[model samples]
Target: MGKWTNLIKQTTDSDPISGAVNTPIQLSSTFSQADFDTYGHFDYSRSGNPTRESGERTLASLEGGKYGYLFSTGMAAISSVLFIFSSGDHLVVSKQVYGGTFRILHDVLPRFGITYDLVDFSNIEEIKKAIKPNTKALYIETPANPTLNITDISAVVALAKEQGLLTIADNTFMTPLTQRPLELGVDIVVHSATKFLAGHSDILAGVAVTNDDELAKRIYFIQNAVGATLGVTDTWLLLRGLKTLGVRYKRSSESAQTIAEHLQADKRVVQVLYPGLSSHKGYDIHQRQASSGGAVLSFDVGSLENARKVVEHLEIPIFSVSLGAVESIISYPPKMSHAELNSEELLEVGITPGLLRLSVGLEDVEDLIDDLDQALSYID
Candidate 1:
């Protein structure tokens, strides 16, 4: 990751007019035409903006992809990639995905005749079993949302390639620093740049990167046609955040592993779901593929009342919705991120009433542990 730190630090060198060290935010909605019969590289803001382009270029380079498209939100990024599939197409998705993603697959896409099968990727046999004649894509979220389930990217990509299906991976949790899906043979890698890439919660953004030229073109077209492109200011903000991603993630991951171990040893804690822990089922595979365990983890407090008490009592981490910020985020996934699911659906996906997700921040590990210990004391 030291190499990634250096790579991210290298500025875009794109300011031809000002020759500024920092990338300039091109706020103009429309660029001037050079001649009566020709146009410049950028014609309109929705299609292309210098600021957004700079961010996209950096992201594409980080993920080792040919092109990257920025979007208004994480969902927008995923939607742009999925838009490539027409009606009557089918997709194979991971069983425990983000609630928003599941909602789109279950509620919205069906309206257009697109169908999906949610399979437990922990068992690759299930993924193979779920594939069918109409299945055109394999959508995966490794170290999956809230549950921390890790899938074998290389195996899935190979299976998809053999089946003549495109592979799409949601790399939001790990980012390119820890795991690069494109390099692992995934066709498309999407991110909720609002999380770790931004490194702070101030801006909302998303990015989709791919090595395939045709897929990139389609996503770029959808980005413009759907009109979900990111704004000039937030694009620059994400660029600033990317500069320190390596250092921030490294520090936060150390703290996350520490917190996960601490929670695991406590009698009141029912389970600690972190790939960093040896007890985690995905620990070995995650270690093989990712540089680190990443900065997020989940634990159960054994009861709904205990979980509520801990959230109400914790002082350092914010009891909030999103994750991967300067301040630690302690969220109840069953109620927050995966609220779209009912009690039965939650149980099916291993999200219990007492399950809580923790996004380790830049806070001192000792401080986070102390704060969590005091909060857990309230459970008894």
Candidate 2:
């Protein structure tokens, strides 16, 4: 089947008992045991739910993985994956990861004795130097947040394989529709489904998918043990959102390309960070691995004052935190997404005060360009 056909088919499932076209949400907190020794598939909601199971199966199929798990939030899903490693394990991670991810690694994980080294994933040598005898995994976010720096997924996975390390990728930016990391040799793929998979700004959800049977068992055990599973309602909503991901992302990516090109030509813009742009540092490599340049792009206007001016004058895109919605969103990395990092830390990772990340949506490309032009006009 074609990707579009598979996308809709895999995401949509019917309720067997109700004869309904949509998967019915099972709201029961617990189910009765069929016999003394044999319990139903879902004995408790924390461990599993019918709606969540269906959603997970769909997610796994979409990502070309064998197993999938849903979580309460994106961070929860990531943290659960990290928890799979033992206390003494070390990890090599991309430096410019999401703020929440940095927060967990910088603050939360240390207490548990797990250590990590933040390295520039664009440079494979840096990743190589960061690995220690205790290193257990290489975690990355391609088209990395705020900067839109692309990492060669296959290159990184190859390195991980040679070193006997697990490779985990955060596919929130691309989603499974654009890039299936597992197919490219990634051991596990994670997403903050709240951003793209849900397609609406209403719910918070997360997903983790893996093809390895042993890894799947470990992830499932953590998901069940931590009790941070998605609710039945959100699971059903996520499924609904997934059905339209193909069309939504297509429109969003197209708009983003036009916007990125427009920003690149504008004199007020110091730099445009988008894989769709031919001049982007990772353009050639990105083209090799992913089908689209994705919907998010970032740009710098030279200073914090100029950034404030542009953001304040913006009319169309809402000045908000999250991305990947029907509505366009503009985010300031220093404050909105990477607030946990200090000024020095942010700059070190190339997240400048002047940087603005835009998550393009299903809007008229010309209108979005004009709105951005009007806002950027205030910078001078």
Candidate 3:
């Protein structure tokens, strides 16, 4: 059998007699085996579970990887990958990334003597300039958070290989459906299943898919050692979320595109930042790398005061922190997602108080626009 098929088959979960796939959650903390091996190698839930294995295996196929590992959250996957590098090793990352990741790079990892350089990945030269002799990895997010900037994964991967550095892509925003970074040459692909993969704000999980068996084993070691494996209930929740991902993307992406166009036309808005925009800086590159424009978009409303006004006044769309849910929601990254950042730090990544990010849902386009139109008046 092909490697992909084999991985799928081995990792798949099924009812012993029923033959039902995507088997029910296995909550047992320990499994019994014969010959005093009561807890077979897979004895504990933290080391592995059927539900989690199925989810990881499914993601492995979707991302075109030989193996997949599920984590307690997306950050866990990223943190673990970064762990491979020792103290004093340098890492280069994009300037505009998910708030939580930014915090980890800027605030936490440095404590362990792991220094990182935040650069404008949109410019290959800038990234090249930032790469130090001690650089161990190039961590980036395409269609970056809040700003939606795109990075050329193939080019970056080639660059990393030439430098003998590892490459990791945060594939959460694109999901495997839109962009398979691994296929484009990324060594590792990370996802915050909490968003697109889960398609609901119900579960918090993360996963890393890789083609390298040794690397996978190393990551597995850390995952098991760290004991951040996904819980049974959350794994089931993620499984349920995956069932409708295609349908969810279909409706939500359309709504997001229409809203982005409408926002571009509105005089009150300074600019619209969606990959769907023809004039967007990375729109072309994004199309080449991603399957769709994605369901999330961000825009500027002139000033922080105006931004606050629109978010606080939205009537139909719910204002919340997360981006990919069944209900339309808006987020103020500087306040909601990046509240941890200091004033200067937030501004460094272009996350100004006036910037408003939107996670479009399956709602009707007219209502979303109407809600925004009415909310615009509240800005003044």
Candidate 4:
């Protein structure tokens, strides 16, 4: 928005000619600085683009961050944060996080001689006990990945601040509208724009926002050096997707609450893991920190065989690995998302073969329920 609030109102609104302010796919790789300004800036697409810059500024404004950088994918944005660390440094992360993030922390970072601890952040004592002298950052995902366990944001932020450790939070599921970790004592906030942030499944992208100037400089250097920035078209798509995020999330969450309630009473369901449900383990903590419970929920059939049958027969919820889309989706965490986790670890996190994670979409609740009901009949 050119560091101006008035720019935001104009840029976000539809272009007067076609009702879309963002240009249609600005793909020009290089720009002539002399034509615009005497000093050189954003000379190449690899370094920057007007379309991408617009999206970055929009996101940063939403998250109350001074800067935002778009990336090729969520993992890329997350990995860029690791640029702050090096060999001998340690990272403290939550055990119940996205499988991709878990693997990066446990498998890839170790190769660089960086150590990590997968701790139960729900219990602040666990985090305190696990901290080592080398701990550089405390990485956390509240309403943590599959399990839906939540860590108290204020407590974690307080402890991290006291320990002189950088605080990093994954706000993919919540988006900035629901949760602003940056305002809650966090140093950096990251998002998988592929998910809720984009509000549509059309693009695969990631974004990072922060208030720290030095951290922004380091991340900018990392993106330039590593060269994993999102394309101009993708950035435009993400921005377009972001425009309707508020609506999509609200509708999806409404459907999810209905589905969670419908499933919780089913005899075939062993558990319905949704933060929106008052019975959920993280319901209180999530409510305290977030404006609304998210749309994704996980529930387990009585057995592994039953889970397979349900997914196979579902007519409404698409069977897939990814989440945060317009269509309802079902996934088996064990074989799908978290396959890399050993059997023991999978069981420990309650990600049995029977565990089916449902990503609620903006669909008719009755239609979704009917489809799910018919699928459950196939399980028996």
lDDT for model 2: 0.93
Per-residue CA lDDT of model 3 for 1-380, tens digit only, reads: 64334434544467787787766787898877767635465677888887778788887887899999999988898888777777899999998888888778888889999999999888888889999999999998988888888888888988899889889999887777778898888989998888877877888899999999888998999898998888888888887777677778878988889999998998888889999889899988888888789899999998888987897789777788777888888988888888877899888887766899999888888989998999997766
User: Which residues of candidate 4, in runs, are more than 4 Å off?
Assistant: 1-20, 33-38
Q: How do these models rank on TM-score, best leading?
A: 2, 1, 3, 4
> RMSDs, each prediction?
1.2, 0.8, 2.9, 3.2
Clashes of 4: 5
Top-scoring candidate (TM-score): 2
Tens-digit lDDT track of model 2 for 1-380: 99889988887687777778888988899999989999777888999888899999999999999999999999999999999988999999999799999999999999999999999999999999999999999998998998888899999999999999999999999998889899999999999999989989989999999999999999999999999999989998998988899999999999999889989999999999999889998999999989999999999999999999998999999999999998999999999899999999999999988999999988898999999988988876
Off by over 4 Å in 2: none
In angstroms, the error of model 2 at 181 is: 0.7
- Model 4 gets an lDDT of 0.84
* Residue 178 lDDT in candidate 3: 78
lDDT of 4 by residue, 1-380 (tens): 42234334523745556776565566788877775447576788878877778788878888879999999999999988876688999988888888988888878988999999888888899998888999988988977777777878889999998999889999888888788899998999999999987766788898999999999998888988898999988887787777677778888988988999999999889898888899987788899889878888899897789998898788888888888999888888888778889999988766776788998998898999999888887866
Q: What TM-score does candidate 3 reach? A: 0.94
Kindly report which residue stretches of model 3 are placed more than 4 angstroms away from their true locations once superposed.
1-13, 37-41
State each model's CA lDDT, in order.
0.91, 0.93, 0.84, 0.84
Task: Give one clash count per candidate, in the order shown.
Answer: 0, 0, 0, 5
Stretches of candidate 1 off by over 4 Å are 12-14
